[model samples]
Target: MDSTRKYTAEAPPLQEVQQTRGPLVLEFGTSWCGHCRAAQPYINEAFTSGPDLPHHKIEDGKGRPLGRAFRVKQWPTLIFLRDGEEVERLVRPADSASITRAMARIEQN
Candidate 1:
């Protein structure tokens, strides 16, 4: 799977996400979010080394069901999943190290 960079306004249904079978990264935030923008570099850096990882850059806001399903209360929340189950998460990551660590956890699966 490709590592997605652009945030899509459309997100997959919660059920579809839960049914996913491999390592996936769900990033919840909006293009207009300052924290999200600031975190992109580190996010990109991490993904550069994760070519096989499937990533969904979901645009999030009020009334967005996918974000709500994850109980996201902050921008730039990275949820790492293995076999459709959450393994790690980072909120507003400050550097690539933390992001890499979370990615590693999921990549191991």
Candidate 2:
């Protein structure tokens, strides 16, 4: 994985992502999802800050291993985790601003 890019698929391992003080940001959606596709660029941009936190993507729809584990019900849901525990989540985010804001808040906690 490119260190500077937001992941478009499976994110870093949970333990690795939680190693930092900052929270981990995950984009859980498949490539075919329109909303997920749209969110890609912004998700990439969010990583530009490179906040020293882990950023990952798990591209799965229904019935897949990761999808079932996360219990994702919508496309393009952004899940934030702190210390391996879910901290914030936004489904089909209204905009990148909201997603980034959520990340910032989660990182603070």
Candidate 3:
């Protein structure tokens, strides 16, 4: 969808994510987290620039109720959701290849 912009969990009801008929990858991150910051560009580059997947970013902080609901414990956690349910998730990218591969998999489904 080319949503190069970030999204908040509070933006809307999440049930639609699963019912939309395509895949959605939610990124949980915090601003100061080096791993999270490092992964952002890779996500954009991989999805928006390359495969063109519908990507969304959520910040783990007091204002982000959705992050709290997801129980995000670390930075740059990639969660693959299809039909509003979690299908796959990677806590942290071991390397660039793995990160892009994760997104690629999400794009595939």
From the highest TM-score down, the ranking of the candidates is 1, 2, 3
lDDT-best of 1 and 3: 1
Let me know the TM-score candidate 2 reaches against the reference structure.
Answer: 0.72
Candidate 3 residue-wise lDDT, 60-86, digit = tens: 676566666677778778887765677
Tens-place lDDT per residue, model 2, 1-109, is 2433333455455456446455776667776678877776666566554355565677666555555666788877777887767888888775657766777777788
Per-prediction count of colliding residue pairs? 0, 1, 2
Best by lDDT: 1
Cand. 3 TM to true fold: 0.70
Report every candidate's CA lDDT.
Answer: 0.88, 0.66, 0.66
Worst 10 residues of 1 by lDDT: 1-10
Candidate 2 deviant stretches above 4 angstroms? 1-22
Estimate the lDDT of model 2: 0.66
Please give the distance, in angstroms, between residue 31's alpha carbon in candidate 2 and its true position after superposition.
1.4
- Model 1 C-alpha lDDT per residue in residues 1-109, reported as the tens digit of each score: 3434578999999998899998889999988899999998888888887546888999998999999999999999999988889999899999988888888888887
- lDDT minimum window of 10 residues, candidate 3: 3-12
The per-residue C-alpha lDDT of model 1 at residue 69 equals 92
Q: What lDDT does model 3 reach?
A: 0.66
